[model samples]
Target: TKSQKIRAELLFKQFEDIKHVYYYSLELGKIFSTNYDKDVARAKLALWYNKIEEYGYDTFTTVANSIENHYERILNFFVNRSTNAAAEAFNAKIKAFRASFRGVVDMRFFLFRLAKVYA
Candidate 1:
């Protein structure tokens, strides 16, 4: 909870002039695996394919294509780290460390504290 207000205030700054927009990207194979209606889901998957082509792509498409092209090992990666949780967790930890040093009321004491805590 150290410096939570400062963190929240900083986070709130990002939304100061925000605009709302909606964009959808889909993972059709996963949807179909547990889909309620087989026929409708299949049709929807086709529609999503068409929409993706219309919307085009960015770098992720290349990476996704690589995954499919490799197919053997990378599909296993997609299964395990389904989301980017590991990377996000590291970033969150670093942010917390930065937050704890916010006041830095005493440089000598702060350095000592940081060294003791992180050493």
Candidate 2:
């Protein structure tokens, strides 16, 4: 395992793009994985944006632009580190339940059954 890691590091050093991309990914993971304050998170994200631009990779440029576009919404994560995961999961469950029943026929009954089971 140690040898494998050394070989991987050598390869990363040999490839400029790979090294940049790998470090960028690692930095982004560190940014989100830590429970940093909002200001600290924002500062890190700003640094990340600049770093991505400096990398000058087309794909990363596009991703950076997207982040810029949704900047506020993304930053809101630092407030509570919450996401719409629960809502999305519930929606998926509803879809699966409907599919299992071969689709909804009576809207009223469907609402009642959904409320009884999931409410």
lDDT, candidates in the order shown: 0.52, 0.91
Model 2 steric clash pairs: none
Q: Indicate the residue-level lDDT of 112 in model 1.
A: 83
Q: Tens digits of per-residue lDDT for model 1 on 32-105? A: 34423545544554565555555556543554455446644533333433546778986786568768777656
Q: Please, what is the TM-score per model?
A: 0.28, 0.82
- Compute the lDDT of residue 72 as modeled in candidate 1: 45
Clashes of 1: 0
